[model samples]
Target: MSRPLDKAGWQAMADTLTARLETRAYIDDRFVDAAGGETFETINPATGEVLARVASCDQADAELAVAHARRAFDGGEWSRLAPTRRKRVLLRLAELMEAHRDELALLDTLDMGKPITSALGDMAGAIGAMRHQAESIDKLYGEVAPTGEEALALVLREPIGVVASIVPWNFPMMMTAWKIAPALAAGNSVILKPSEKSPLSALRLAALAQEAGLPRGVLQVLPGFGHTVGKALALSMDVDCLAFTGSTAVGKQLMQYAGQSNLKRVYLECGGKSPNLVFADCRNLAQVAHHAAEAIFHNQGEVCIAGSRLLVENSVREAFIEHLLAAAESMQPGDPLDPSSFMGAIVDATQHRRILDFIRQGQEEGGRLRAGGEALDGPGLFIQPTVFDGVTEDMTIGREEIFGPVLSVFGFDSEEQAIALANDSVYGLAAGVWSQDVDRIMRVSRRLQSGQVFVNNWAGGDQSVPFGGVKQSGNGRDKSHHSLAEYTELKSVWIALN
Candidate 1:
């Protein structure tokens, strides 16, 4: 349901949002400064208005945060706390987040230009995931290895030391929770560095964490450019592990930084140009068209797992295009604060230009522009939900990760041809297949080189499943029990009890 444009309700919500933004960065369980009170202006992507001046934390601030985290981890006040105590704190944090859901959702929409409805959904997902991680702690048990008559061996899962989480601007609150909740639940101290474009929610989450009775330095939020603070966290010798979600280029650089300083564990969930494959056997053209539209245009098409490439069978090409165009019209960009908006503004002017540049490059490379192509004439950085048909596997848009609301459609004749075209990209993050034939689904699902594949849907799964990529998309998963392995070190303790 669209949030009613109730003037009084909106005005009150806006006032509450402004109050939340009064303080920017949260460090060591307190709202503080960046060495000299230096701050950067945060823009409201929905309206191109200045929201607030946030602390522009740099290497110095990162160093201070790392120091505090190291102390907290070494002191055992938090890191060595009983699992039940830690779980209680995390569960409490989840409760606090739910209580302030409206404030957090508004903060996300104002800071990152996501539709209010989408932001609320993301907030709810974050809360549920955090609660799940908290609940899983007591149930987790280590193993006992079978040894011969010589010795008794016990396998233990131990928390890695301080964890530095670097997250991107898109889905700020939820991504932050994806990294922090697991690390905290695993008993590791964490330092979070959120994107400069959307730091408000992360800062607010830090306050909530403290309110939940988490020890000082257990969780700290730093807001700044990636080069200074993010680099500092990556290179810090005291940091035991680094979890990041962003571009493949930055993820690679962080790996280098890890190697250069200390061989700390680095887990990255990077870019994607996911392919959505449709076969002629799928008779539901209308449903397919709708899912295809939502796969790309959702969140202004600013998702890592966005189905940016659409590969359809040649038999259904013309009919699919017609329905797809009809579906695209419903996803035009609108005011992000309005819950009715299905598509919101691009994260910022810089990203908007990048998307447009990619569109022009797609045209230059001979891809046919089917639907929306240009940015809308409006106040915010809103682009039309674009679709390019007759796309070949060789086109620039077909191979590269646009990370926008642009979908490139290609037609293939046979099952093998479709698999070949879908697997042609350098990325193998995600892919989706639509068909009723069990044989085709099994064959394609096996041969398709990707971390995750959807049978009837595109880009969906619960927190129970692992999420990550292969090849240039980067390594390691984010959700599920698999992610806990990234934050903990397995140890084998042996005893000569014989």
Candidate 2:
């Protein structure tokens, strides 16, 4: 279908989808009920309506899915397929996803409360990532190591079997693609445990994968609470590797579970308290302020690499705040299905309450509320774009990952102080530097402890480069050839020549 022209058009399409939503776990090339036949309600955060009662999978389901995945991996049906053959499968899957772009976008919007427009962008990103990884399958070359004249050596990259990808509710389709695309392209059987809050798109994607010529038992989708399905995947001896994108606390738990289990490899892309610095030397304060608001308010601030902290040089602090407040005014939360709505509802009531609590804590801790710090009057879980000025490095809102549409503004007298404030947090997933001075941008960008740094920009990068973080933001990269390495093992071979 073409892009919906108006809110009514989108809502009508969403109503059509609601009547026949997929609600079962997809395993072994089919949809089935949970082992215990239990179910859980997935709420539409925008209107507080139950979209579906999806299969509430648990440890038993995880075990079943893993067993299927292991069987498929060892059977040489997909794992031993030629790289070009795997490439064709992935390319076909991408085509299928493109064909159903509107449905997938609506599913994520209805499930997780992201704006329809943003969800469409996510579909494009997901499809692009799939195609990129597919094309890379045959292009990635193994190495022929140098040796003496009497000997020959070869190094090969082999797929790690049975990858479990546990993704977050925010940006569900894109995050799922980031993990499963690379793993599947690397010839691994994948058991995907999408967050229960947003599993419709993933469950639907599994069927498309099967239709795209993926072998039976090669791809499975199990949706449930983290304590059950997630824990099981992390602790499963049959699972060769686990890749996750979520909170730091959960990432640490998975690490501990890895140690307690069969020592499977774990790759995490977790939480962030990213800092955005605006030096006075920046040529365009107005543009910087607009992007600064977008960095935190877009997607209702559910981004893992959201620039939650804004550090400004004292010289232009007041001027920047004026432009930033104006930008925030244009980003008020609205119905997610509305194409004009840039910001949508919070993911759920629990997250809504957590964001409110942090806002309250920010006031209690003496940070001045410069702009909206209250919830919008609506049936949905929506909050105004909140900005806290006078934030110090010691403030709770400044140090912690709020993961909401909240921006903490801090002022620094010197470049040294700005760098110090930016690096003062336990999380360092991403950061932004705004400066026209080439030397200063170079200096600050190198000194900041972050996985990705955007200079004169905010949150700008593509799948060609790696996406990940250091410190508590979690280790391991995603979305590039580096991500493919995570799902593969290196094998070195030496041959004697007569």
Candidate 1's C-alpha runs over 4 A off are 1-8, 20-22
Across 385-426, the per-residue lDDT of candidate 1 in tens digits comes to 999998887788888888889999999999989998988988
Candidate 1: C-alpha lDDT: 0.89
Backbone Cα, N, C clashes tallied per candidate? 0, 0
Q: Model 1, clash count?
A: 0
| Each prediction's whole-model lDDT (CA) | 0.89, 0.94
The TM-score values for the models, in the order shown, are: 0.97, 0.99
Which candidate leads in lDDT? 2
Error of 2 at 417 (Å): 0.8
- Kindly provide the TM-score of model 1 when superposed on the true structure, using C-alpha atoms: 0.97
